[model samples]
Target: MNNKPYQRSELIYKDKIKKIKDSNIIIFGLGGVGSVAAESISRNFIKNLTIVDYDIYEVSNLNRQLYSNYDNIGKKKVDVLKENIKKHCKDTNIVARGEKVTDSNIEGFFNINYDYVIDAVDDVKAKLAIIKYCRDNNIPVVSCMGTGNRINPQMLTIDDIFKTFNCPLAKKMRKELKRLGILSLDTVFSKEKPVETVDKKLGSTSFVPGSAGLLLASYVINKIAFEE
Candidate 1:
């Protein structure tokens, strides 16, 4: 077991600290949002983490991704993220899956029995597959909706997907999830109207994605630590 990472958190959460340490969490997507969420969870002494992402970090990702600094631009995302986590939280057990999640392969992804699932992938197909699988299995999950083309960190909030608005990604997801009969979902999303970007490339700022990631991590931590 790893030593408690936050002395102040242990002081307030008390025995919930141990509960956190004992819990297993699996986070999908190692991009701007997922990277920060995964690191935040590790910092809280959650010893077991499963990180999944198929892409390699690119120069463009440095603007928003935590693990995508210039020094490691071409590295596979999950591999670099795993090494970064071990560098900081050495005792935390990390399982890095460097592959995309699809309905065909989703069954293999969930074999670990995670206590919570964080969905941060931008791909709609993969995102829905994860959400549906978690919902069907009765696992707790929090998903992130569209962090791109936005600039306001304060607009972020966690709510059921049906209640979400203003985020175009959330709107599409709401329709698809409803079609699949997945009535409700917990997610972190922004209410800021998306800004138009030059040349059709998505525009994102550091704070928005970073805040969404941390908020998702906070929700998971609170759910496991204080909720039944």
Candidate 2:
């Protein structure tokens, strides 16, 4: 190997590595999808990353969450994710906030001008808040729709939100965006219908949310690295 770290990536990114490294990105959740997305982006050597999440891991989250484990149970997700990223990523600068995004705090939470934004939160209101703020400000953003109650990773795809179907979360977001007069949005969503289970609670696997997370990071990285 010609270098110790990022050698393979450096071969592919070449001169664009600096641009990718310099891009400022913020993710609004640290659940399964957001956790995987944050780690994936950090592994790519992206320098500036900010993650916002208020939830703490419980026994239920062990199913699909990237940072959830027996020892991390009851700990704040943002703190766990920040520590995880910092452990492996020396070049990346991470900001972790434990505050829950709300109508009252959305403005304050999004005060900074971000190059790109990733929406991975589970709350519909918070997701819409982030999308609205980014849209009104003309900031580039991509959102992760529903990954819950699904198992097939292959069904995950990225496209305009209006073009998506079969995913309930996408439908809700689409309707809300239309009502807001926001015509278009970019998002990672699943084409497969959510599997009906015996219990009413939503279910998930390691694959679906994780795959969407990978696609989310890929969307940002490709735009900054490959686009001419």
- Say which candidate scores most in lDDT: 1
For candidate 2, the 10 contiguous residues with the lowest summed lDDT are 1-10
Strongest candidate by TM-score: 1
**lDDT computed for candidate 2:** 0.87
Candidate 2: residue 190 lDDT (0-100): 92
Model 1, range 1-228, lDDT digits (tens) per residue? 645457778888887888888889999998889999988998887868999999998988989898788889889999998898888787788999999999989989887779999999999999999999998899999999998998889998999999998888898999999999999999899988898988978888988999999999999999999987
Lowest summed lDDT window (length 10), candidate 1? 1-10
- Would you estimate the TM-scores of all the predictions? 0.96, 0.95
Number of backbone collisions per candidate: 0, 0
Estimate every model's Cα lDDT from 0 to 1: 0.90, 0.87
In candidate 2, how many Å is residue 119 off? 0.2
How well does candidate 1 score on lDDT at residue 151?
86
Candidate 2 residues lying further than 4 Å off, grouped into runs, are: 1-4
